[model samples]
Target: MRAGRLRGTLGSADRPASALGFRRVLAVFGALVLLVGAIAAFALTDQVWLGVLLGAAFVAACVNVYWVSRRLQHERPNR
Candidate 1:
């Protein structure tokens, strides 16, 4: 361990950082927020079952967004 040296057992150098497009990230964030709000509203109204459904929807949205983002990343090349 040294202050000026990178620390890692695996050999990796100059690997590009991973990230999703900003607008896509924002869209997913908005959808998640809406889903949370819906779940909260349903729970507040004592509609627990509906809230559960919304929760499931939120999970589905998250998975779909992740899959789509991966696809987009693989579909293009970095400049």
Candidate 2:
């Protein structure tokens, strides 16, 4: 009976795909943000202040990627 209960619980705990899916989504979002930032920087190459804004956006996107990577790593269990 105890073995059956354990098996039932383990079966319900099978959510590896959900975690990976979230990470994949975050990665794609971050890439999109970085791409937008790069395009903005190129478009505003003549304006110093706009360049600063684009640089800030690029930095923010990099920080977001780092944060998401940490979250994904934390969610994954060591083998």
Model 2 TM? 0.53
lDDT tens per residue, model 2, 1-79: 5543433221265422335546657776876876686677778567766667766776877776777777667655551
Candidate 1 structure lDDT: 0.66
What is candidate 1's CA lDDT for residue 57? 73
- Single out the weakest 10-residue window by summed lDDT for candidate 2: 2-11
Candidate with best TM-score: 1
Candidate 2 Cα deviation (angstroms), residue 23: 4.5
RMSD in angstroms, candidate 1?
10.6
Instruction: Compute the lDDT of residue 7 as modeled in candidate 2.
Output: 34
**lDDT top scorer:** 1
User: What are the lDDT scores of the predictions, listed in order?
Assistant: 0.66, 0.63
